[model samples]
Target: MNLPVMRVLLAEDDPHDAELTLERLAIAGLDVEGVIVNNEADFIKALDSGTFDLVLSDFHMPGFPGSEALRIARSHPSALPFIFVSGVLGEEHAVDMLKEGATDYVLKQRLDRLPIVVQRALDEARERRSRHDAERRLRESETYFGQLIDALRDYSVATLSLDGTIESWNRASEWLFGYPAEEVIGRPGDMFNLPPEPGQPTERPLVERLAEISTGTSLAEERWLMRKNGATFYASVVTTAIFGNGGAVRGFSRIVRDMTDTRVAADLLQMAKEQAEAANRAKDRFLAVLSHELRTPLGPIYAAAQALDLRQDLPPECRRSIELIKRNVEVEARLIDDLLDISKIVNDKLSLRLEPTDLVAILNGIAEIFREEAAARHIELRYTPLPYPVIVQADPARLQQIIWNLLKNAIKFTPRAGEIGITMYQPMPGKIAVDVSDTGIGIPPQALKRIFDAFDQGEEESAQARGGLGLGLAIASSLAQRHGGTLSVRSEGQGKGTTFTLTLDDPAGGDVQAPAPVETPASPSTHRPATILLVEDNGDTAEAMQFLLAEYGYEVDIAENVAAACACIDAKRYDVLVSDMGLPDGDGIDVLRHYAPAADQIAVALTGYGMESDVRRCLGAGFAIHLTKPLDIDHLIDVLQRDNRS
Candidate 1:
């Protein structure tokens, strides 16, 4: 079969030989396109300007010598098939020309042999062209695949020789390891792993795993690997062995993905949880210490004010001012108590003392306390009692606190001359509801949902002068729920007023009865003078207690710390011992521990530390009563007088 056409350059000077060569090339199974040239100028010009499959030349030319033509063709950029077609040349000359980069020589006299020689020469040239194209395509494909691997940003890809020496690295590998291809190629692959961390086993290193995979499969594992920047991170690496067709190991490929971010995120979440818990603990501790610090000094101030109120020598105005001082001091103490209660409620630590409580009586008692404050603000406070009293099984003190917080919140938001009313009734058959309504700036519709949220004022500072810490309503709501009740609010949007209703469980199924009187002042009672040991840490509180006890006809010996109280107890006997729970040196419980006072002698606990746990521990330590500060001196005197009578 005839091959495709071949383009030939003929440099023979003789016209006869050039025509014969062209004719023979055409007769061959392949087609031929020939350019004939003989002189050095035309031959060199043709060779330089034209593309040919073969070059045919004579031994000598008119101007361009055949040797020089051969030299020109050899020196050209591309390879070309050069053949001699001279019939006059000696065997030695022809052999020498063949040695000078010639394909073959054909004699003009043996012209019949021309077709086979041309066909053979053209066939070899076609093979050489095919070989060059294949090699170029192979080089391009290798470059494209290399770049594809290098473009992977999340994985580090590397190529290693069979002996575990790095042969090539993609750009991603360079980025992850901090080593460029120029610096790392031909080095051992172990350069990626520096000194391993402690407890890193030496039994199966990366090199060993790579060696195992050299048999033709892939090995995947997770390990702690190092980087050129001296950082260590966990990575998932896959080592695959590349094999040749002969089934022999050629080289290896490694792909690695870093696993640091997910691990660090989990660790950070755990750390954040720990920090939040620690902050909660710190807040609780601060509240406990704050309660002690706030109430300790107020004990002396309130007692002093109460003692001053008892003076018959004072004018009516002075006595009235003293009563205001005492009333406001009680308000300050209640504010401190609310702060502690809210903290306890938030931390899930608050406990209530549930009993059979007359809801109306509890409401009426706390209502009287706020009347004077309301009158001062020119906001009339009124309590509309039910026709009959409604009683519930609930915490009386906590119930009073809930009612008090509502009144306080009302007074805080109510403008001057605004009226506040507390209406008590049975809203349902099994429920008793106390609705405290105020004529004030009403709540917005959006804010009504979160008005009872802790620390949520829900009102602008201009609308209401800020007084409390915004936790009062939150505590009220919490206390109501604790007593099997619900506290909710209703507002007619912005300009209208708001009403807060407290609904509690009515455990007593029978009909309501006439409400009992709330409280009456202790009638000026006379008590015998008694020897008392008064243990107080604050000097002001100690001095004030002594004066108040003297007024109540008792000889009081004051002690400032646990050590002083212990000394006082060891030195003398007393009728009653008043000990503050928290002392500078040790707990006031220590004094009770040192000297076991007889049951007949009153062991009354006077303490600024007032939580349920604190009261329980004080009672467990043999104190007859646990009285919180700013020690209600009137209540204390009543207890003392009642105990003396008993």
Candidate 2:
């Protein structure tokens, strides 16, 4: 459908001869378009135009001879064929002219041969042009590939012979292995390889048929290579074989990358990790000691206050003061508990008891906790009760804790008469969002990003006035994440107000039916007053614990050391052994070992060391239950009664 256009320059003085030549070229099956010139100037001009493929000239023109035209054609950059078609030329002259540069001579009387001669000359010229074009393209391709190969300074790219010898190397090879191409080439590629480690089988690595089945994959392992100076560096290398048309091996290409820095960095990172782990262990040990020192004294203080509160003959003012003392003591105990909990969370030790619970009921209970506090501050606390139960799969206690934290912060930062709002709504299917918003001093732009970080106070000026460790939001956020949810905050600006939202994926829709309830183990209904051996080092704590146990129908024997406890155990049979972890003679666990094998008795640990690991250690020592100090008497009674009945 498409054809090439060819330009022919016909150098003939006579117009008739030029017309005849054009007609003959067409007849010879030449697809040519021609330009005719009559003189030396026109012929020279046509040659200078540089658009013609074939030049046919009259050998004996008035000024321009066929020889002169041939000379001019040779002078130009392109090779143009010049031919003689003259009538006045003798046989000798024609032969002489042919020897001088004319392509072929055709006598005028034999003008019938002009087309034949013209066709043959054009064919040879086309073949020559094609060969020149292919050579030019080859040169350009070699130049481009050379530039690309030299540009790679990171990879030691090389070409190899089929026998695993290096044939060529790039600049990276010189820099990486410290070997110049002159020395490395024609040498076996394994010159730098060390032997495989013990227990690894020897195999030829370079000739492995990797690329035949896979385009790319990581090699089995990193190999060590020796440098020119005898020092070793690790290298990650890959070799791909070059294949040809019949799937025959045509040498190979190997690419090597320096991994010495990566190897060194990995070692450093491992050391850092070990150091961090050691630091965490030390921190845990310190917390254990601190918890024991702090909580041991609180046990006696709380018990003494309770003993005072129970005095019927005491004055009402005195009773109120004792109650205040008890409440403040409980507050201090709660702060210590918070510190322990945060440590547990940081160490990924926070455990959860997940159950399908009524979210609405939990929210209502949280609202009731802060109602008095909100009123004391002259602030409005508002929440709408849910008409129906919204059940969710969550740890009920943790969920309550998150809400308590946000509500406490809302109450703390809000000024007197400021409004605080708590709202819960399902914005869409498979979604539940709870928002706690307040008209308080909002967070500034600079502090917003770090508001959820532990101990980061958004309002530095109010940190002391607010009087908190600023760990609530951090704990809340962590708890939310552990629940497969998120907690985020937004503020308009300082003094404008802030809103915190908690979002959870509600795959269990509101309309979904609840599962049938499971039965719980009922306590055995039997009458029994248990005997308790209270082993405590502190005199006041032991006295108060014994007094509290007696009120619950427990006959108590006090032991302030391991020897005293062992004596009491040998003398009398006891139903429960309540002991502190630390003792003057030995650990409380040693007392358990002495008494536990003698009888079937319930052992309980009432200790000041209250980390999760400490509890595990106590449980591992055969205690039925591990309880921390500043004891909740009701919970203790419940535990004691359950074990006594069992």
Candidate 3:
């Protein structure tokens, strides 16, 4: 069997004590090899040879002491176990040496305990080295992790204890939340001014909230947090419960971002979209107005044609045809006027002529226009005048248009024999409300959300069900807004009926008189024979207009395109210049620029582009009138007659 080996370096001036300790170690069944040194030099030489497991020394020697020998042994590559075996030193001195890093010491008189003391010292030195190594490794790991957290730039990292106290704060956390590690660490999470309520503890503190979350009874919430300077901002806050090894609640982690700018930008974009949708609705309204006006003239024209075909008695048929033609021509004239009104409104060029107007008179006039239609449908349409002649500061014609559109909508939507009520009342001292209530198919809840949107009919399944290009309400609403009032609708839902209320500003100052109408010449037929220049790219339309003008007894000249029209204008002076907006060489605006006609001469634009903006462009370019095709023959005739007189 192999015995345990013990190599020892002995520092002593006396050889007898050293030999005695080695003999005792051997007697204890330790295989011992010993080197004897009398001073520090020999002791260090023996330690440097790397042949000893422990150093056993006398406390005092001739020139050196056991303390010196111990120091030398400790300075070696492997710190040898150091024990002071001394006879001259007292217990106090020996303890002093041990405290100075002497592993242990045994008195020379107690030779029996020397071997046990040496063995215990060796075991302790091994343990102390192992503990020192472990501590160094732990410090290195902590430094590495700290550097890793500091390197992160994007996200704020922090740790909290189970009690909601911050235990660790990272650099990113300091930059994002405006709190440094020194100020934030060891404080409760509420110090950062996060929600349940900023700068205040939650009703149930974060710890309890986390506990609730762990129990599957609570969800995290996002909210606005106030900054250190008390500026409120949005954040996407996410709270998650941290878990211990056994899956118990530890704490929570929260992440936040400022969303104020993002939300504002999103709102701005939404507003732009709504504006675009409003513009589209306006375009739809224009289409509906055009369709209505065009259909009116066609009704009489169709009737006249039918009458002429059915009658065999030539004299009566001729009279009926004459009457029919005259009526159709008048209807066509009104259609052209309404189209021009719609165009002006669309282009934003339709300026309101504001003046003091009797509100009752305007309502009465609109009611009279709709009375025949209401009578035909057997619907009761009546206006209840206010207690007094409630005068308002407004444009009479525009206000009349607003009321007429509303009444027409009521008459159109009301079922046969349904009641229509119109009432004007003073809701307040400075406010007047006009309520038009109808017993008809009411708006559905879903449709009401977008009822004022142009061209947005609640349903499109039936032609009658789809109301007038949805423009009447939109235009009426716009008009009300321009007049510093509001138009709003309320309904009980489908099949329940609906009411539209128009609230206007009451006249503050005293009322003024309405403007008198301008009367024209009695006989428009005896107008002067005027020279006319017509420019058109379409041969068929050009020929028809030319023939029509000649029949009306006017001198007519035609150009196929803008270039020819400009050349013609340069060569002659005409009473009126009629040109299509689009030509082969250029647009009508270009021709107008070339002609540069005197202000008194009339310039009329004829084109297919009927958008409000298109008409405005023509007027802005000095056109007296703008007309969209297919042309109204009688309106053109009337315009020619008027221009001749001018």
Candidate 2 weakest lDDT stretch, 10 residues: 211-220
User: Which ranges in model 1 have alpha carbons more than 4 Å from their true place?
Assistant: 1-266, 463-466, 513-529, 611-617, 620-622, 641-646
Residue 21 of model 2: what lDDT?
Answer: 74
Q: lDDT of each prediction vs. the true structure?
A: 0.82, 0.82, 0.74
Q: Each model's TM-score, in the order given?
A: 0.58, 0.65, 0.46
The order of the candidates by TM-score, greatest first, is 2, 1, 3
Report the C-alpha lDDT of model 2 over 520-569, residue by residue, as the tens digit.
Answer: 76755455677889899999998887877777678899999999999999
Clashing pairs in 2: none
Candidate 3 residue-wise lDDT, 1-646, digit = tens: 6876878888878877777888999998889988888977777777777577888888888789667777777677877788888777887887788787788888888889987887788788779888989999989999998888766775566777778788888887776677778887788875655446467655666666666667534354556666656667665656656777887777766555566777779779999989987886776566545653464344335334443444456687587666666545544544454555555566564666678777877887777767766887899886665444667878887788788777867876789879888988778778888999999888889888887776566766632563345566767777888788899999998777789999999874323334445576756545567788998777756766676667667789999888799889889998788888878888999988877778667888887555556767899999989876666656787886676655
Candidate 1 local lDDT, residue 113 = 81
> What is the Å distance of residue 383 in model 1 from its true position?
2.6
lDDT of 1 by residue, 1-646 (tens): 7566788888887888788788876665457888988777887788779888788888777677777888888888767887777778789988888888888887888877877777788779889889989999989998888788878988999888877888988888888888889999989877766575599765455567677777777888776788887898878888899988898888998888888886678779989989988998787778767888888878888888878877879899898888878878887888778888887888788988887777776776788778988998999998865566677888888888888889888888888989999987677787778889999888999999999888788866733567567788999999999988899999998768889999887776547666677766556546557899998878888898899889878899998888988898889988898998878889878888876878678888987766667778999999989998898888988888788766
**Clashing residue pairs found in predicted model 3:** none
Worst 10 residues of 3 by lDDT: 295-304
lDDT of 2: 0.82
